[model samples]
Target chain A: MTSPSVPAAPTLTPALGRKLHPWPVRIMHWTNAMAMIVLIGSGWGIYDDSVIFHFIYFPQWARIGSWAAESLLWHFAAMWVLAINGFVYLTYGVFTGRLRERMLPIRISDVIHTVQDTLRFKIAHEDLTVYNAVQKLLYIVVIFAGISQVITGIAVWKPIQFSGLAEVLGGFQGARLLHFLGMAVITGFLIVHVALSLLVPSTLWAMLAGGPRLKTPKLEAAE
Target chain B: MRSPNRPATPPDAAILDNHRAEIRMLERRGILRGTLSLGSLAMLTGCDISDDTSIGKALRAMSSFNDFVQAKIFDPNHLAPEYPASMVLKPPRFNAYYEIEKIRPIDGPNWTLAVSGLVNDKQAWTREKIATLPQREMIIRHICVEGWDYIGQWSGVPLRTFLEAVGADLNAKYVSFQTADDYPSSIDMATALHPQTLLATKYAGETLADPFGYPLRLRTSTKLGFKNPKWITAIEVSNTYMPGYWEKLGFNWQSGI
Candidate 1:
């Protein structure tokens, strides 16, 4: 909510828009993007190195580095970057009240309605600042999925010392399976996320350059 | 029942069937599948997955928790599943840091296993004397960290028998092993005393081939292949943790599957 004394869009212009993402958010966003790419690519190679399911195998092209050892190095290195960057982003979000404002206040009804709206193709691209119920749900899920990947990653990486964590995940073999499954979930989310971004090009613009270009509609006057 | 004219299933096929049944058993026990879904994970770990630092810390802490749980649940008496002799892989895969051709042959006649550290018997064990110890044979799959696995028949004195004969301090925390090839490794005492843990002398019913760590090797199904050190030269039991070659390079010390 904007204060009464301050203008709504400080840098709004006919051709451009105000900054929606702060510098920290933008920096962390790109860093996270890079980390995810490295993680998924290297993760595939690691998965192929080990046999989990008897019948299923990752395609060769999906694998990252040439060798298992090399892929593992990339996976570990990217993991650290992802973890630290995620930590900073989360800390900033919580302390700045951004997480609460954006992702919270979700209701079961909102989720159900959003799913129905999505299925019927009736959803509107109304407000860039305000996340739709479906967007909120997905963002939350993806965040959690990232965390799960890290946890399962550690369990598989160091099963002996982390035997308890691995055991909770089922065991060494089970942890490997869960790790692969987590990767699959994240990959699925990435696909849907990219498609949605393409559908809403303004959202992509906001992510890359802070905010979307548009005229303030009557919704702001109502607020 | 099969007709007399029908051919019997190949030995390797039987082994594969046994492996499949074992996997099914694990699945049934909730060890391989269906137990660690996202919902269950959320419940088991109280922190929300979106809470990065808390979840990371919690998961790291859980590693130790896992170690504790595994240590408690480990059954020293429980044996790794064994296969029939016909299932043994021909020319069991040679795996080592060095190439097979570069492996320096240990002179079998003069070779002796040195015993040291927290043991009453400090005398070296000659191959002949080691052979006289009560022997055991097992056909177990050697799972490698690199992911391939092979079933092989290993014949040796039970490590427990050797430890007891050496008057080892059974309460020691760790058992360190040093190989003639300069590769060092260790295992927890509980694992050292496991019935399946072997001071292997032979492979495929004959004396261990040079490439397979002739004279002696450590063999156990509980651990990954790297944990089973070959060309073993010395044994030391101590309270302090001594990391192995791969373990020093970030591999888990307790590499049990």
Candidate 2:
């Protein structure tokens, strides 16, 4: 077996998009999904313990780890998983050119058209291998949100050690606020992404089982 | 990330192996069996598939790893930022496990800092005696693990100076403090020797209030506010790991910022 990101002039062709969700991508995606769920739930628990906005509070059932201390454990542990998983995903994206080919060069006109199609209830799902403009935009924004969340999280976690990062990110309070906002953005993305996947169950299958295969296959080489 | 799978549709053998691998992992972890909706997906992912004592153990291990990381990254010379006098909060915000009305008042003049454990000089020093030591004042942020912080001026002898003066085993694993408030907290040797760690007797140029750490209190820049024990009674330098009040109740013992 070869590394998913490497250009192997061999099995599992990308032509029919059979290589859409390689094992690494699939594993990391699922792992990160679980990690994000844990992080978000436990983070909410921690926030509720000593709330930033006193009036706003997350319900207990939606939270992980019975209390704030336990929540912190879940949060920190999940944070490591997220960090490692994210780093791997990023490396894979860059090295394999998946990020450039699938998620870049987003044009305003394309975004507008995608929105128009969605509004008219004419959403297209003909090509499961490729991302729509809206999908690309959403993915890009959430990636930024994830990056910001991690940065602010570290700053809040150790303001004294990462003093400059804390200061730049707005100290203790500001870093927390940014982190909170990042969670909101990611949560929103999850709702949309999940709903879309469920709406077109084929996308879910694509992620789960590598979707469709070509009748006549060539050695998968091209990234 | 897992290695590339050869076929678009995995064969029955691969499927069976994946299931076997998942079960093996769960058995290896000794995790409590629960009806996990996505158990297969969560396998080998370093995530808790269900709520159980197993996750708790995993988290405790992570906390210990973090403690190691904290110590590894700690710099002896790096000082926590000092604030201006204007930034110092006069009559700083009060926080204790108990209520303000329940503050155990102490007679400041009669207070003696009893030193014990791994020290050449185990004599008790009175408030007057500590006052005579070289004083270093700093205005640093007092941060709470609860996510609030305050800049307050604390003036007292540096802990490094006091530890050396007392002929303490500077290499001791822990420096523990027992407060009159019945709160006990301890810090690592590295943090104890940090230039900003102070046996602060005064706040904002005046002696600490009775509700605060009157007579004497441990003020550390790098630790959580709870680590700063108030209304001190005794200091012990020990090689043993002595978990403090909150620490025993599940807070990280090395509660460094």
Candidate 3:
């Protein structure tokens, strides 16, 4: 056999010729993130103000008084922004098939590979793809959660106008409970996502700057 | 487990190519969903944008601001249009809670208006005392925030007339209404004393039903259905205002009809 081919040297460089994120995707991503943060924060305010949960005793210093009406107004207004933005983004994703490519797993293998890569920390910084497996799963989950919130919100908004939907959800009380639960889930996920971002600084930078510097590994030259 | 600190291998050209292909597909799907949803939201926006739609404007204006966002959709100054006597309907199903379990007569002798707290005088008066006062009648539509509406004729003394006699104390901020059924609610004294508000004793020209505040009820035409507390009982005047039953349970307190 001919002498073994020499291995190419590893290099550290800015991701050259790599496509930057599309404007719509970038804009929507940041907007959704910011809106969700505001919504979850204001939602906590509302929960604190709720009379039903006011039975719990807290020190005067630790306790926050209920401002139900004010909290409701905050929630309602922010809801329109969050809802409209999500509707636009989701619609765009579906029609453009971007949702299927970026947000949805292409196949079982891709999903499996993603999971394995995440578990093994085998994801490459230089990967041209925008999201890794964990990110993809989270994006999908958030979209579904947003849809659930809209459905449950309407059920509570006009119980009579959407009587059938309300009935399906077991009336106003049930709808209210579901809406509360949805908020809690979203809030929980947000906390986890922030934590992960801190753990993976590069991933956070990718979202912020639309790309990151990646170090390519050395490879053996073919004989 | 592989250490994340270790550099990850770059995905091969084939994988990148596959991702590019998938991204293209997703892009197309995303565009379709975006257009469809945008169109739907546009339609929704259009419905609420017209300036002449009082309720829609109120909802939208209030949506953006911290204020109550009242457009004065219903004018309290104007008397609620009277309905023909024949248009009045009786309770097909009596809607009383406490009296449903037990029948109780609310007569002039048994009924007393407890005018106290934040008032110049704290005293109880017989229903006869109320009946002897100047009476006014109006046919008004009771609109529930839940969206049902019904027209009923009310005959009673005006709450403002009573407040005038008692001389409301300067510190009085709200009037808390407690009915015989134990159903309770509160309203700003200003709202309680509004011209359309009546301490009603008659409906459809007949004596009140036990289920319908037999001797008297606080009938405020300017408010949603629940604000018009039924049944005659104690009235406490207070210096601070708070939410009522449904209001505490997520319903609007002012609950303008």
Best by lDDT: 2
Kindly list the per-residue Cα lDDT of model 1 for residues B174-250, writing each as its tens digit. Answer: 99998989999999899999888999998998888999998899998678899999989899988988978875454
Between candidates 1 and 3, name the one with more favorable lDDT.
1
**Candidate 3, residues B30-148: lDDT per residue as tens digits?**
56545623222222222113333332344345553422432233344544445586777665134432446675656656567777777776778677777788988878666544333
The regions of model 1 sitting more than 4 angstroms off are A1-18, A212-223, B1-110, B113-125, B128-143, B147-214, B218-224, B233-257
* Fnat, 2 decimals, each candidate: 0.10, 0.37, 0.07
DockQ pick, better of 2 and 3: 2
Give the range of the ten consecutive residues with the poorest summed lDDT in model 2 chain A.
A214-223
**Tens-digit lDDT track for model 2 on B74-181?**
778888888789998889989997889889889977888899999999999998888888999999998887777789999998998999999999989999998888
As for candidate 2, its clashing pairs are none
Q: How high is the lDDT of residue A215 in model 3?
A: 26
Candidate numbers, best TM-score first, in rank order: 2, 1, 3
Separate DockQ for every predicted complex: 0.05, 0.19, 0.04
Candidate 2 residues lying further than 4 Å off, grouped into runs, are A1-17, A213-223, B1-52
Clashing pairs in 1: A163-B66, A164-B66, A164-B67, A165-B66
